[model samples]
Target: MIDVKIFQTPSGEYTGFQMSGHAGYAEYGQDIVCAAVSALVINAINSIDQYTEDAFENSVDPDSGSVFFQITDRPVSTSSQLLLKSLVLGLNGIQDEYGKKHIKIRLEKQEG
Candidate 1:
């Protein structure tokens, strides 16, 4: 099971993402989930032509059966938004539990 959260600026400019969950087939494991999320994030970053560097900021284990991923970077265009949505949807579709998990994408602008 994996939970994903995406944050975007109000002007629809910058975006960030956080994903956490279990990776293994029988039991949810952080190692598997971390690797999978890492790959997904990398692929997403590569899909955008304008993005120079999009990488994971941190991966922490606050407890057992849980891992965290923080991805931050600029997206080139609206296409980038659509690409992220699709990527998240695809990741969630991997399992039935994932389908039931809650995923959030929020858009907000930078404060002056």
Candidate 2:
């Protein structure tokens, strides 16, 4: 299972999430799993724009297996919060056939 956390910062909001619980064959080719996970994350972030006007700037740390999403020069609103929740939950559904699972999301808002 993956654990996700979202937190707020002075600059912007961020989502910190991680995945675990893959053993044996599922653990053999982690690179592929990472790639798939990254893709799913990117897609979910992109989907947020459809629900809100805020544009998202994202970075994936392959080394730490963490993904960060920030709003670039946009006003944050209640809609943005809702969108964020939806985005994370959507990505959590992505799974691998090797018993590797992706789940959990943490979101934080940054104080201006």
lDDT agreement with native, every candidate: 0.50, 0.53
| Residue 5 CA displacement from its true place in model 1, Å | 1.4
| lDDT accuracy of residue 89 in candidate 1 | 60
Which segments of model 1 are wrong by more than 4 Å?
8-14, 26-38, 49-76, 95-112
Any idea what lDDT model 1 has?
Answer: 0.50
Provide the lDDT at 92 for model 2.
48
Predicted candidate 2 versus true structure: per-residue lDDT over 2-112, tens digit per residue: 555555555654333334332222464555544555566566566666766766576666555656566664456667656655555555454324343344344546454
User: Per-prediction RMSD in angstroms?
Assistant: 5.7, 6.1
Quickly count the clashes in candidate 2: 14
The list of candidate 2 runs beyond 4 A from truth reads 1-3, 8-25, 28-40, 49-53, 77-79, 91-112
Question: Candidate 1: which pairs clash?
Answer: 8-108, 9-108, 10-108, 10-109, 23-29
Best by TM-score, which number? Answer: 2
CA error at residue 49 for candidate 1, angstroms? 5.3
